[model samples]
Target: MSLTSRAATSLARQTGRQLAARPAASFQQHRNAANVAGNPNESHAHVTSPFTRGASGRQDTTVIPSFKRYRAGNEQGNKVFQYFMVGAFGGLTALGAKDTVQNFLVNMSASADVLAQAKVEVDLATIPEGKNVIIKWRGKPVFIRHRTADEIKDAENTDWQKLRDPQPDSDRVQKPEWLIMLGVCTHLGCVPIGEAGDFGGWFCPCHGSHYDISGRARKGPAPLNLEIPAYDFAEDNQVVIGT
Candidate 1:
């Protein structure tokens, strides 16, 4: 045959062979993909699916969108629930604060035992003139004196204006013969000895403070008179130290 015809025949045969091999190559690829998916009859498209599809052709995991699922009428109800929650939290917080304040007040207030000792009552018939009686009231020493005539005269006649703390003896006592004052010294809260100082009243040896017969601060570090407390004579023969 001619050279050109021989060349054309060879070219045709090669094209036919390539065409025949394409289907086999495609089948082999399909078989390989099915084997990888553990099902020889399944298509590669099913095996490579990004998500599993349901019978309705939608992804099995699909859910209705939030905006599409929400209804306009439910908005007020949701807001009301939120407001209720906020108000409940605020109420609880206020209640806790109130309880804390009340508990603090209860703990800081004076106790029953302290309140029970607020006042002391004494009978004058047990005491005599020229004698000093010491008693406790409100956790402090109280000096209750039944003064003699001479002591009362000295206390009233003293020049109170010249003292460090100026006060008349008449102001210190309800009666001229009765003297009631806290024994605690004004300088350093020490207990002073009654009727035992240079002033013949009370003496605080701790700081050398002295008080007169009227419980007036006279010398040394004392800056004020001995504190007088509330008292009443209940009857002609009986005196109540604290009333």
Candidate 2:
């Protein structure tokens, strides 16, 4: 045979051998992939996961697009936020209601100075001699009296035995007979009953307080004299309760 023909024959045999080995190599690669996928109990286990590249040039990486977890977490967070908003709104509404009720539903209160300004006028003809007329002045009870000769004599002649401070010469009273004083008791603010011709003063029923014709507290639980309201006689017989 010729030299070129022998070389061609050798090359042909090599090509045939390579063609037969190609299938065997592919089967071995597939067997390795199958073993990696199925055998979980293997000691040196190499998993053929979707996140890796295979030796056969196959793309094992898979882009799994699923919004299930995101949607579930978002729903749970939305529920929590909704509950928080509802609680906050309820608290604000309750506070607003309380403020409205406090501002508008309660009765208005007046000052003490306004109550102290009330005054009234009394008729001079109504008050008789040796008697007193009760009148309201500056939210307090006042007594206007027309003293008789007997009562005035009794008040002046008595030794002031019923008085707390026994100073007759000190001139607490402006008039000798005519007395105008507050009818309220000095201790606890009770109205005293005006008496005449005996003790010559007012007698309190609550605590048995006694006052002279000049409204000086003479006996009982009262601490001081009955208060005298500021007044001026408008005429010979007319008297005003307040200044």
The candidate maximizing lDDT is 1
TM-score attained by model 1: 0.62
Each model's TM-score, in the order given? 0.62, 0.46
- How well is each residue in 61-161 modelled by candidate 1, as lDDT tens digits? 56433454456667889999999999999999999999999999999998999877766667888888889999888878889889999999999899988
Report how far residue 92 has shifted in candidate 2, in Å: 37
Tens digits of per-residue lDDT for model 2, 16-79: 9999999999999999888867864472445444444445434454745455766755678899
- Residue pairs whose backbone atoms clash in candidate 1: none
Colliding pairs, model 2: 162-218
lDDT, residue 92, model 2: 100
